[model samples]
Target: MPYSYEPHYFEDLDVGQTFESAGRTVTETDFAMHSMFTGDWTELHTNKEYSEDGPFGARIAQGPMTFILSTGLFQRTGIVERTVVAFLGMNYMDIPNPVFIGDTVSADFEVTEKRDLDSRDDAGLVVIDSEMTNQDGESVFAGDMKFLFKLKSDAE
Candidate 1:
C-alpha cells in the first residue's frame, strides 16, 4: 500500500506521530556542490587521495552536508511545506557514522513534544526527534528539531 501523504497543521500533530522519507543516494556532485557553496574544502572531504589514508579509508561527506541532506529528505515528505512558520532550532546533533559517496540515506522523524504558544494564536511549537540512516542501517545523523507550525484554526 502507498503511504498516504496527508497535509498537517499544528493541531493535527500529536506526540509519537512518526514519518519516514524515501531514500536518496549521496553523489559526487552533492559533495562538490556543497563544498563550493560552503567553501568547505577539507582534505578528507575534497581530496580522495588524502581521504584514502584517513581513518574512514575513503572520502566522506561533510557533517553539515549530512544534516542538509536529512532536512531535504524530511521536506520531500511534503508534510511541512505549507504549515511550518519557522525553524526554531536543533539540539543534540550527532553524526555516529560517516556518509560515503554512493551510500543511500533516508530520514525518520517522530513528534516528541508539542506546546501551544500563549502569545501567538497563529502558531505552536513542536519538537521532532530526527534520525538519518544509511543503506547499512547505520545512523549518519541524529538530532531534535524544533519548529513553529501554523495552527489549523489560523491557517485559513
Candidate 2:
C-alpha cells in the first residue's frame, strides 16, 4: 500500500523560503534527562560549583542538547512533516554561544538549495540553513541540514 498526503515538494521550495518554530525554555529536567540518556555529565553542564569557576560563569546546557532541541523546534513547523524520506547530513554545525537553563529558545530555518535527484523519481534533495536562538536573539547554534524530500508530483 502507498501513503497518501500532500507535501512540500522540491518544486515548491524556493531558496529564500523561511520557517520559524515556537519557543521553548531550557529546563533542569532537560539537562537531567539528556545527561542520563547520553552519560555526558561534564562539570560544565552538570555541576554548578565547577561551572561557576569555569568560563561561562554558570552551568550551561550541553551543546548536543541544543542541537536536539533545535531539530525538534524545526520539526514542529510541519515543513517536512510528511515529505521527508531521510536525513542526509548536516554541515558546518557551530555553537557560538551558551544556552543556559531557563533560557527560551527557538529555531529559524531557510531553504538554501534544492536539486533534483536523478536517481530517484519520487524524491529530491533540499538544503536548509538553520539557526537556534535564545530570547535575546543571539544564535546558539547554526548549520545546514540536508534531507531527501518526496516530490508532490510523484506522490499522486
Best-fitting candidate, scored by TM-score: 1
Candidate 2: residue pairs that collide: none
Query: Residue by residue across 1-156, what tens digits does model 2's lDDT show?
Result: 111122476777888888878788999999999999999999999999999999999989888888888888878777777789998989779999999999999888898999997899989999999999999999999999999988888877
Give me the displacement of residue 60 in model 2, in angstroms. 1.1
Clash pairs (backbone) in predicted model 1: none
Q: Choose the strongest candidate by lDDT.
A: 1
lDDT of 1 by residue, 29-134 (tens): 9999999999999999999999999999999999999889988887877778889999988977999999999999988889999999888899999998989999
Which regions of candidate 2 deviate over 4 angstroms?
A: 1-7
Worst 10 residues of 2 by lDDT: 1-10
Task: State the displacement of the C-alpha of residue 77, model 2, in Å, after optimal TM-score superposition.
Answer: 0.7
Instruction: Report the lDDT of model 1 for residue 95.
Output: 92
In order, candidate lDDTs are 0.89, 0.86
Number of clashes in every candidate structure? 0, 0
TM-score of each: 0.95, 0.91
